[model samples]
Target chain A: MPATRYRAAPAATLSIVSLDLMRAVYHRASGRTHLVSEPVPEILAALADEPLDEVALLDRLARDYAIEGDAAALGERLEELVATGLVEQL
Target chain B: MNHVFAVRIGPVGFRVGSDWRAPIDTLADLYRDYPAPEDGIPDFSVRLFARRPWRRVLRPQVMIGGDYTIPDAAPLPLSLGLLAAEMGMNLQMALAQRRYLLLHASCIERDGRAILMTGESGAGKSTLAALMMARGWRLMGDEFALVEPETGLIYSFPRLVSLKNQSVGVVGEALRGARFGPWQRDTPKGDIRHLVPDGASIAAMAEPARAAAILFPAYGHAPDRREVAPGECFVRLTQASTNYVALGERGFDTLTRLVRDVPATAIDYPDAATACAMVEEFAA
Candidate 1:
């Protein structure tokens, strides 16, 4: 349970820009632009530093951002991030 | 709107044919400074047809057709024939141009440096760019700016600047010798007019300049400015680009280089003069 890993997908680089009201993410590998807000960016920034499994990442993010949310929901958000190649699970 | 005019603007060649003589004549007079590609055929075709067989003789409407088309697009009345032809060409370029990364931007060049301005509709990019031409900056293009993917060079397209609503009057007063097409009323974009590029822009259309900066300008605001980080600029550029996704890896690499190498800023200005001042200050 403690011996799991997750990192940004191979060859996938996230370039974030600050919009007037939101954030835009450019996925270099896909040449696609995504508009995101709030914790999505905070989460990506943290994960970009080091690989962490789902549970550990949520714990770290909750501490770093002082966020209060369901662990199951955070896990689902991590699942979506993995699907979009912004994050990975190993 | 049944004469054909072949004119080359920058890297793209266009053959515009119209069923009515008025539109073709207008295009010929406006584009008299440009020359057709002597050796090769035009890259795209713009055809203005009547809505019905008898509509040409009766009320008359100009339906834009071309090598590529947007299905169920609204038709323009014959009074707006020239605007229809221009719109058709812009549409084709937006949908089909692939050799370069097409940014939905107004580009102007000076001192071997080019600055690209883009934002949502009514951003005043076109009006400011046209005004900059009056101030001695070469107008590269108003509809789209072509960036060569391999070299990261910004090539000039220099199509006629389409000014909508109050911009038409604002630009009319700003530039004394600016050439404009017939004023169009009640079009999709209200009170439209086209301003032909000056001889300088026409002569230098083939020349390419290195991209120096990118700007996102917004009108109707108190004077303000903000620096845009490269990551944000890259993302906005992808959204502003017409064919970034279609160009594949070439688009990615070229855009990456642009955002990394050039600086980006967002400026809010109330009028063209203030906007022009903001650009000069930033580029300086």
Candidate 2:
């Protein structure tokens, strides 16, 4: 069995503006502006480069950033991004 | 289309046509201080007409139609024809205007800068703006704050301030000797009256000012003030705008700049006086 993988929309498709506590992302594909906090933006940035399954995504996050939550939390955040059409599931 | 009245507010011009003369007469009186549309041509045309010929004579109802319309909008009694005309103009701007970002907020300018107040209905922003105008702040607008997406400057709309219920009396009393439109009682919003913006606002309608700060005000609450974070301001403003989604990237870029550059605060007040005092302190 193969694990599921996810990738973010291309950087050009999103116009991300950083406000102090959150980021306002304008998704050109959906024409929706979403306000996302810390881990959500971090996850999207990580997924920008390539599609990664849960374990690899978590490993990269843990190595590269100060992630506050566990694998379950990361999974939940990824689901939210996918729901908003900011991330693609494969 | 027997009667026509045209007036320019800030950067937009509206020509209102009606089957009956009364509403156009009322609009002409209320907007007398305003100039005619640029070069005598209006940017938008609003029509107040009867659904049928007999509807114009018996139980007359004013149906709002214009460059854009809600097709299913219920007609207003001829008594509320003025409101219908105003609604028609607002509908055109809210739906069709793309030259500027339309914010459902009240604004006032002073010393070359403006303060924008936006919140849910009954937030007392209109009353606050009217009161602030009486106290010498230039009334930019009550219904909508038009922001130029390119320059980020706020233009003056300076239309008649719609005063409802108790606010009608509060502002009427404060603005003694000021021109007022006829009062219509028991309407949808309740006891509605229109207050003409002061002469200075109309005279300076063409001038634009930079936005100084943003305020989310709530009436009938214990006096409290808090600083709003930029992220919260950004979210609130997106909801406050009528054409943000339609403006696409331009809207996002302009709004982000506004939220980042301007400070935002939320003020809850027990009464108009307290709200005015808090605003004065902040503006100073």
Can you give the DockQ of every candidate in the order shown?
0.20, 0.85
In terms of lDDT, the best-performing candidate is 2
Q: Which candidate is the best by DockQ?
A: 2
Residues B1-284 of candidate 2 have per-residue lDDT tens digits of: 79999999999999999999999999988888788999999999999999888999998988999999997899999999888988898899999889998899999999998999999989998999999999999999998998898999998898989999999889888899988889877788888888999998889999999999899999889999999999999889988888988999899998999999999999999999999999997676
For candidate 1, list the clashing residue pairs, or say none: A17-B232, B1-B20, B2-B19
- lDDT tens per residue, model 2, A1-90: 999999999999999999998999999999999998888888898899999999999888877886756778888888888899999999
lDDT of 1 by residue, B1-284 (tens): 25899988887899998889999999898888987955659999999998888998798988999999988988888999989989999999989998999999999999889999999999989998988888889999998989998799999989889999988888888788788999888987788899998899999999999988899999999999999987788778888988888886677778777887889999999888899999887456
Question: What lDDT, from 0 to 1, does candidate 2 have?
Answer: 0.91
Question: In candidate 2, residue A6 scores what lDDT?
Answer: 97
Clashing pairs in model 2, backbone N/Cα/C closer than 3 A:
none
The TM-score values for the models, in the order shown, are 0.84, 0.97
Query: What lDDT score goes with residue B142 in model 1?
Result: 90
